[model samples]
Target: MVTGKAIVLSVLVTLSVVVRTASQLPIPPRYDGFVYKNRISADSVLVEAFFDPLCPDSRDSWWPLKEALRYYKHNITFIVHPFALPYHNNAFIASRSLHVANKINTSYTFPLLERFFRYQQNFYNKPTLQTSPATITQQIIHFALEKTGNSSFEKFVLGFQDKSSDMTTRISFKYGCSRAVTGTPYFFVNGIPLNIEETLDFAKWKSIIDPLLAEQAQAYT
Candidate 1:
């Protein structure tokens, strides 16, 4: 009994409703990392960093990043993603060690990363000794025990190495590749790529981040 016009109107209304529902749904968060400042806020800006612990450039980048973390501690959440480049001989093993350190205790993540960066040359320059996967794994296990003073952490690292370490490393590497990351020390602020030059300059970083933080503050006011 319905007229053609009424049928068309009903279809249009249904389609509009579907579109509105889809638009209102929240987008899923991308980029998982070792999260610092784990609070959820509408105004909070996320800073995601992709780095290899052994890369000199990544090590250099950490100083400025530390300064930024101090300056923006209240307004931002920082996430560290390990992207192990193939060229770095021990990168994969080093990244897996970081994952192991994070699993045993999140507190150890930065320290372990710092240790690896600090001793990277020593790890690289093995003249008489051959650095196989098992050798590196043992070295990390020993390093973790020495640093953490927790003997139980050894079992966790060994288990991770045997089962999930490679998978976890690959997943992080693939995620970085998907995002078009081709080098170490890449950063994303609020899902946008942050310039390397800006990363080192506090004034430049503040210029980009302050405006976003201001917008968030205005919304509350």
Candidate 2:
């Protein structure tokens, strides 16, 4: 009986140590900031998202919101920010790559975003996988080639890295840190927090978005 008790204690100690170590690791950056897209109006009810490409919840939240965009194009402006947490091995590189893509071809953003989510494990850090920035860039470039059928992906990728990559990363990280935003798929519609896990309802979206757009429209009129 005493020997069994000792074994149990040892197991508990091991778990405790593991838990502590995991806890000490940096949490992935919280989704934060305002990213406006295809501005149709001066005050198009702005929607901002803090997202992680590898996060399942981010993937879940993305489609519905993206679908809603088509219907609300003239009435709303949507912006994205990358609040990638440091603990996530490839998140920073992924986020930086996103900004690069944005500058090269704005059209590439959503398609690439969807691809990463659909193939999350493709980018997840593995013990044996090369996780350097160059490798990550190649992965993105390959995806772009397949998706866009653009042979110029090489030029676009390099241009993004050279011009706006670092700036975009800095802005995303700073915005997230300042807002204390910490989650995979957090959003604000007209500066109001969106409960993505709960409603995410298209009709529910209209309820909030319509009013903001109307208010802005009235102000302009």
lDDT of each: 0.76, 0.70
Give one digit per residue, the lDDT tens place, for model 2 in 147-220. Answer: 56687677656765584566667677767665567786888766777765663667767777877777766887
Residue pairs with clashing backbones, model 2: 28-85, 29-84, 29-85, 35-79, 36-79
lDDT of 1 by residue, 102-131 (tens): 767777778888887787775664541476
Judged by lDDT against the true structure, how good is candidate 2?
0.70
Best by lDDT: 1
Residue 88 CA displacement from its true place in model 1, Å: 0.3
Clash totals for all models, in order? 0, 5
Residue 25 CA displacement from its true place in model 2, Å = 24
TM-score on alpha carbons, each prediction: 0.77, 0.70
TM value for model 2:
0.70
Q: What value does the lDDT take at residue 3 in candidate 1? A: 100
What is candidate 1's local distance difference test score? 0.76
